[model samples]
Target: MELSKSGLWGDQGDGTYINPILPGDYSDPDVIGVGSDYYCISSTFHLSPGMIVMHSKDLVNWSSIGHVVDDITQISPKLNYDKMNHHGRGIWAGAIRFHNGKFWVYFCTPDEGFFMSTATNPEGPWEPLQHIWDVAGWDDCCPFWDDDGQGYLATTHFADNYQMHLIKMSNDGKQLLMESDVIFHQYKGSEASKLYKINELYYFFHSEIRVESGNEVRVVMMLRASSLYGPYEEKEILHTHGEELDREPNQGGLVQAPTGEWLFITHHGSCGYLEGRTLSLLPVTWMDGWPIIGEDIDGDGIGEMVWGGKKPIAGYPIVLPNQSDDFKHPKLKHHWEWSHQPRSDKWSLTERPGFLRLHACIPLEIGNFFTVCNVLTQRAMKTAKSEVIVKIDLTGMEDGQEAGICHMGTQYCTLGVCQQGSIKRLKYNDTGTCSDGPIIEGSFLWLKSSWNLDGIHTYAYSLNGEDFQDFGGQYQLNWGFYRGDRVGLYCYNEKTEKGYLDVEWFQYHYLSN
Candidate 1:
């Protein structure tokens, strides 16, 4: 649903917008301005169709355009459904840049080394990822291109005492020279590197943990150097100005608007596991050739997070990332992604004409929904209250097949239909524990879940679309797998892959407080 029309967030229509430009998980945001259009990419750890790419015109309104990687198996087989591992891993943090007439994306998995992909257009048929470095224990990588057509990579080695490195690369960004120079090493937990050459000075943006009054806080930092291999100067550019640094805003990229105004698009770096790290756009003020993020509320020469602000570019109709699926299109929406790489042959849109047909597969671990191969999901909105309702046809169900709507975080809860031989029963599965309900004779079921920003989940079901009966226990939403809680659907079998479920439509609404 559109953010403006829904009143969920963004574009207040009074020339100012709220903090979260988009209301959802959307963590570790990296944005770049390609002419009049702005593109943002977020960390999609372990989510198939990894590293979501979004587009915006006014910086306040954004929509999902596509993803960088389609098949995440290129990173590792352990991330597949059979393995069902790497929950909080995969696609750590990445940077996006418009260079050489192509959109280049660079990122590193925590276990696997660095990888990259490129496309001429952001809504893309992106080139397959190129594994540049095969070494491990490195992450949060960004690429830089010099005026002389030279390429360099700035990354952090977390295993090596939080040491940051600068490595030379071919102009093509495919090969990284093993010659590495330690750039910054003084800070603890320093990472999220983005390299930029602004006005003849090299500005390296990153984040590091610091102890203030016995509180560990993550803050945005900057390193300025005259040369690539630098005698560099460091400064803390942005941090929470409150007495307690709870939601520290850090780890994002800087972009210049069409009006020459600069802004930082970042995530609320802490105390946000429930909804995941959400997107925040802050104003950038350049002082002494360094960009200070947000507003200097206390006038301590450091920027604090701004809750509301003037739009970067005015008068753009508000847009939000895609949220619902009608199952009418032949291809899945850009917002939908599998928990891991899906068994593509088992799910089809054309097979049922106007329904999403999920052919049940035998889960690698029976009775465990987490190991289900084809759990299709999209990011759950972090609103005051949000609701998702899905209608599914159980005519295709066979013995031992279960299909329903779900709310997945670190822990998950499902409300659906479970078939036992010839009898169909309503079931509620909460994190592997099951609570069976009454038998259902109807072929169609409407499953719904309502959640609040507190992460409290309430689920219900209906034989008729208008009436719903609450079935599941009140479960708290969790921020697990380094991701925000998700709203999705699932179908799987405990015995064989003979059953299936047809989803007619999935509707999501952001309820007003």
Candidate 2:
């Protein structure tokens, strides 16, 4: 589907919006309302400065605030990306809550147990990750504080032994009291648990991938009770019935407007999306004590997809997440993420003042293209067709140090310039197939990559930043773990760490067919 044509940006600008508020891969979103302010955090698997947190005044327009995991050393040594050990593992789905005049985000790594981080401000200086529980058996945990000041955490056990449990915790949000009561033990692939109190009843929201009519799809599962533990009844309130929405829209958080309007900030999982899972906002109606997302078009209790609708909270100008950067700031832009934790001394924005400099570093062991560390990247939108252009200053590059751009994922494609001593050679590495270009004598070049919505990525280069020529085969985009295509800027040397590359600027333009 043409993402831009389908209104992927969400803001229609007419006091109404489209389905996907976020076109790129901001998956497993959990949001909380702090007065007129709404903050949301997303899953950033294996990316340093993990648990991407953002804030919005009107919920529709959002911007990055900070990250939950700033000191990634607390996770694992393999997160350095040099090892490429944890592809899809680090900081899974989490819950964000505003309590006691503080913002707390609770998340767990599947192998690293439960962790929590808090900040007085959403866009923070979030305190260092508090390793709440160091045992890794369950995930998708949510922290709940009752009226009596008693604290509880709702968690889902691993899929191998699927079960939901409500564990007691200390009011200080520090200690888990061990005491766990099983809530539900029957739903297959039940996860993303959110515990909420509404109308004097405890509501547990989760998603269970179920097989209906021989088709596997995600169904919005909910269970509620009068007490925190036990005797909870289950119901499936939402499902995808239209052919337009091929995947299931589930695994997100519920938001209630100040005016009492309810909306589900959800992510629809497209198993085939190399562009990553997209986020959709759906109006929720409370019927018969059950919250139904989407529109009940067929009069069935189960909700169907709502393509476009009026704004949930209007009266604010359009604001969006960071997309492009010119490398003029003293630090990396909030949109830029390293392939893993980078060697801070190797890359610098202050070194060149206006350009982003990536000092060449030899890999621990050169395996796949992904093994190279400090590759900064941002999400590639599903805009049907898009163009990414970057200016590279190759003057300082030395032997074996290559610097360029690529659409990175499981099976990758790279378009770069490799400098062997003083001779610079242009090349395209489509996964493993190599295509060579003319040996250029210039110390500067312009590189661009354009692709359609179907993921047919094509690379191009220009000597003067004006005349661009396509090079290499059409590299089809692919996924690794839960990640989609990440347009990346990389500089690495397999032989020695003696070279560097300066990215003068980067411009991303989404185009139509």
Candidate 3:
């Protein structure tokens, strides 16, 4: 069913309304409304072709525009050893806006500090990376272009010390005008601060932590000031975990609908064996010069999710691109990203008629999964049944050519073919530990993995597409340190040098009810 028809789209009749727009792994979202259209971008850590930009007409539906970082060579290459510099350090938090007729995006890599890039158009040839601030500990930088043509950058320091600062940018956004200065020292372990100016007051919406023994409270807090550089006054808590109307307090963004209404878009933790993140939306109204969130009519701390608003000027049902892959084309889908930098020549399908070929390169240390450069991955959008079918021609399998399918994140598993001597073997590995499954003598084999909703599933290998055998025991999908998991293909070096895997075709089928 289309997302709108699924009761997901929020329409505000008088041309603009609000909703928890893009319900995906798009965390730390920052959006800007240019003219009547809205454009948003989010963080992509350790994933190549980082900084994904999304577009929408109303606040309900969104579509992918392009990536800010398109070239892997422009960023760090995929490292061989897992413990290199920053393993998956691409773009983290991004702030997009139009300043003085030029489109600008300010973003940061946790270990790389903050930077800005500009483009004439949203889907453009963005300019080369321009260094704005390079302080190691800072991240989640959001920039605001004021009515006076001045720019202000706000960001949070990493948890290493828990600090937050706001700096002034030169009029042209070429450099920082002054050293970083304190804005608010709530020391509440604040991050993801977005500064919004309404009327004569400027408000800072941020997250704060309350410390207690097993009573930790991470809530969304707000502060307002008359001046940008402020002795600001604190306001009531906006929302928190377990609120009936609000999802658990997580990174979020606030945008004013075209009809002058306000809405909040944020993510909530999906608690279960698979801790995937889901997005949520709530309505906001101004009361006594302060923005009232979730409509606290009873003066309770919690807020409730509500529906029906003036339909946004342009409203479309919330829809996501198909996650399943057919592999009928010569190139990978835009949703797939490499773990680290990838050499273009290392993989290709254009020359091979019906196969996707990946050439194994230098073996990086395999202890850590995030640093594996050749792992191609896509986010697990929603918990659903899915499987991948690949036909592999193992005729040229050398000691160094190990190709397989994987579910990647902090933790991962692999299921595919491995050739040893004259014997072709089906291999399954759970968290770097491997075991032999089934064996076929021929050069071609079909591999399949079936994932039930709970993520524990079975793997099957087939010589003929019609018949299959359970190749391994059931395994559970686990997340190591990160919150989300991705599934895709990987080619690892099994020998000393380079080797290759020839995959005739790959298809992903999502079973429907």
Candidate 4:
């Protein structure tokens, strides 16, 4: 089945594929190929199950495998959501490589430091994370293990004079030798450094912003040198070629397909949509020695985006990231990553067996609905005309409680059931403004949140699951932090620890980006 038919992106089953092979807010993607299989990781930021790992057979069709970090609390209390706010920061861009029979992933948190994790399998029981470097403010870290077993790690801290460094490291990537060299320091907003040794040369990839047509175009720059240090040649491989339709595609890793074809995977911040940046796969062609990405139609020695093309490696069909839960599984699906590390005791499926039962123990006090800790979220696509619905049982209402659907972004909007004393009212909260509907009789209601590609959102409620009544004004959803918008199902109380809701099902549908 095509990803659209399955409610997401990937495996169109046909010969051709769409732009974002893996859709939603999967920003700053880095991919690697091992043997006949391929794996990719993306920056999850504050979302738990940080640095999501996905697998593929053909390099185009991919699915969520697991997370690099199992215990996010090990990073910081800010990631816990209930403790402090690390909303805009967690894990940034990371590199994935197979070194010495172990799969290694290296990444950094702006506030914390650099960390590495290894796994025997991409779908992992990954080894516990190692904090390799204890320094802060340095982002974009990629690890390289050389042929003679000389290990090196490259990093870029753009905040400090656009400094890029190459550090010597222990073979196992456990210790970071601080004796480093300032490698490349040119270009404004230079970051997302990735290292590759190919054909007896080291090529460092980074994205830089250059003004063209009065716009900050993010161009991909490749630095190459035969020797590890000194006399490096630089060129821009990928960039935005007057993108009025799409933004500039930059900040991704390069990999060769099993069939010996080299390709560049990248992402660009959207101009119109605010659900974060979406992923794009560009075809790479090697001329002379350098690998040029995308199709060189104008023959300017530069490559632009390839909107649609044949799959790089074609074969078996694949599934997409899971959506639309019926609350019947043994546990919550991997598709669901908590806003932070969840409280665990507050939500359950076995308590009622077939419906998701969420206890409103956390106090919201009319604060931002997007800030609540256990708000279960999945990425909203970077297109118009996508909507989600939930069957919620608003029976166990306590005074000053609310629970329902939300469009969580820079400016969030909510349409849910709120309780005041014995009165059960249907409410919509847009930012801080609260509007209410009459008592939702019969204990259960179906709520829906819909939006177009430009992110104009609308909400409705139905006594029966078949029909719905419009209930809220339009909310223009915008991007938040470093990510796009995400639809969330949340429950919380203000007066005290009381109230709960039974979510029978959650369903979503997408058109395109």
Candidate 5:
């Protein structure tokens, strides 16, 4: 049975797919094709279970297979639930490659230097992240292997005037040899480093900004040289083509399909905070040893975004990312990740069998819902209208505990039940503003949150799961911390750890506009 659909986005089931093939906050995507299978990874930032790994047979349809990092705290203690810090600093953009019969992932934190991990299977058992470089101020990094087995890493250093570098590394992808050469330098804002070799020419694909009409516009730029170290020529390959320059499609990977068609898998550069950066698949055309992404709509010899196109590979079952948890499995679904590293003892699926038990504890910063570490979250669908309802058993709730459904981005809105002494009351909170409803006189309550494409949100509560009464005033979703909006379940107390909530199940669906 179909659990959920990607709404009006994704594959159209007619050999045509629309823009934002994965219509969520799947930003800074890097994809690779191995045999008939393709694997893609995206930046997760501070969200735990770090980098998300997606698998696809047809590049237009994807499934969240696994994550590269299981314990984000392994990178730093600040990422732990006790700290609840690093709002947007954890894992930046990384590169995933099938190298030497293993899948290799390399990424870095703004303050924690560089790290790499390896796994034989894409759905792996990935090895613990291995710290490769201890230098800070670097962002995006991608590895390359030459025909002679020489390994090189292409990265961008923010502290050094936005200079992109090419450094030598061990063939095993573990140690950076420290031999570096500056390839591209000193643009307005240059990043997203991807290295590729095509037809005997070394190609470097990165995104940078250009001042247009006094506004900075992000566009994809390419560099090519006969050797690793330049005399490389640079060209602007992809941009908005005189349209809304801010939402340009940039920062992705180039992979060739089984039919020998080169495709660019990227995210729309800047969108509303409500949607974040969404994934888009574009056709890549090669001209004079350079790759042109999207279409040159205005015939300006540059590429522009295409709203719809023929599927790169046809006849694959349309699959959306996992949503709607039944809590029947022993492990959390791949779609779910904590806002930060969660305290393992604070949550469980096996404890209650068919439910997820969240043991409420005082947040490090009491009363701040964003600081609550046990909030289980996933990307909010980038649709005009979407709703999620969660059935929560409030019998375990104690005084000072608030357990409910919430959507978070720049600002947060929550609707749930709060206990004060002996009274269980329905509460709606938009950021720090709280409004309390009538006392909930039932042992079980269902909380619902819905948002529109404009980012306006509403909250409601139901006693019997049949009818819901709207409670909270309209709230607006805002994007912040380099993230799009996220919706999930949160349970926390301002007082003690004795309070908890048993989540029976969560169901999410996209409504027609």
Candidate 6:
């Protein structure tokens, strides 16, 4: 059902609002307006069914429509677990637009350069990925089709090699005109380029690096010219650091409201250690020839958050779905997705009402939580204190069946119940290894986890629901080198055999104001 809160936090009445419209860890947001509808998608690395597409009428409330990639098998014949080629390399910075009679999406896999897909509708029977531009280190590609039907691809190079470049595309939109490659702009750490035509002049906006602070300073730097390909003049930075409106310097998308108001949408870093990213929107105004961003009538460059303005489109009030699971439904929520191809039979709720049955399967060796098939996780929307309450029945669980709650990614910490002999004991810190915590067997078990904005700090378990003993000291939820961490449930079979854990339900409550 719909969560009580509409946006990130419970809706604040004032125009000033929280930065991220969708609180969860949806990074590198690329938004486009089709007719009167606003559609956006974010990067989903390694997580199968990549590229989540969301719809919103007010630009604040959003709901998932569908995904760009429904099956991973279509991309590759055989997927690997040890070191999957697509792991940590699925959909990155996708740009969606309505062109001609079809809806086109341009995305990058980093290792494979850039690819294009199309559908007659936003939520679609999307075509298989087609290699449009196959060049090393080129990513975050956005294509702009001028009124004259001429197409231009603007993109940035990888950090290890090459630099930002723009090139013209063939009319067929399949290949780039090789000789048309032009270095429109070059900054060592510049990427996520968006090309917009305002007042007859083409403007290019991108984010550059902040070497000193180690944060990617998202500067709305612009370059204007009369021609698409030209001696473009670099203008002053329209948005930069020091101003509270400008968060971490990174890539974002631009859109104009139906009321003729200009707005720039991008993400800001939330937690440096967790690499959590939050979305932010700022207003854009054109002065003289160049555009100024995050400014209002006061001439101050800072953008103030507002609510219920002229409708972006006509629709119902937008509300996000709740993450808490009552186990009343037969299947998991749409918000929960697996890291790889999911085995439907391995998970079920048909046998028992108000309970989720997770059949334990062979555990993999890799520590990357994104590759772990048994893990069920959801994105951490905003920096808040969230707790998960789980009621587990350890009866008949084999010695190898380990069931628990985890804050997982490349790194993780788990607290749950494990069965050994005639007793069931509380378990903790059992990450990447089999043995880590002491056992206290009981018929019924309850597990609880408390996480601050910085990650999970404390975990507790109880034989009876009333008394929870501290199972582990403090554990950090660092997932290797990945940008974000997800929290959810895990049940693994160490026996390389089959067993299952019966979970009563899971309740997640946000305690932060």
Residue 199 CA error for candidate 3 (Å)?
3.0
lDDT of 4 by residue, 1-513 (tens): 222223334445787776767657778889898888888899888887788898888877777778898768777777885763778788888989998899999998888889999999887899998988777788888988788998888888766856788888886788888776556556788888998999998888888788866877778888889977858998877767444544677889899987788987787655335556777787999876777888877888877777667888877776655677899988776667778777788889999998998888664334856557578888877443677889988878789888898877777888998888888889988998889887876787999888765678899989988888999898987788787887878888877778888999998876642
- Candidate 6, run of 10 with poorest lDDT: 1-10
Model 5 TM-score on a 0 to 1 scale: 0.96
Which residue ranges in model 4 land beyond 4 Å of their true spot?
Answer: 1-13, 180-185, 213-215, 241-245, 364-366
Q: Could you give candidate 5's per-residue lDDT for residues 86-142 as a string of tens digits?
A: 898899999998878999999978998999999999898999889888878999999
Shift of residue 269 alpha carbon in model 2, Å: 1.6
Clash tally for model 1: 0
Candidate 2 collision pairs: 384-453
* Stretches of model 2 off by over 4 angstroms after superposition: 1-8, 181-183, 241-244, 511-513
Candidate 3 has an lDDT of 0.65
**Residues 137-231, candidate 3, lDDT per residue (tens digit)?**
77777788777877788888765556777878887787887665655544656777888888978888877676423555566667888988778
The collision pairs in model 5 are 273-479
**TM-scores of the candidates in the order shown:** 0.96, 0.96, 0.85, 0.94, 0.96, 0.82
* Number of clashing residue pairs, candidate 3: 16
User: How high is the lDDT of residue 19 in model 1?
Assistant: 69
Candidate 5 segments exceeding 4 Å error: 1-7, 180-184, 241-246, 511-513
lDDT tens readout by residue for model 2, 125-178: 888778888887678999999999888888888755668777888777877788
Per-residue alpha-carbon lDDT of candidate 6 for residues 342-385, written as tens digits (9 for 90 to 100): 55577787877888888876656534334446467676544466
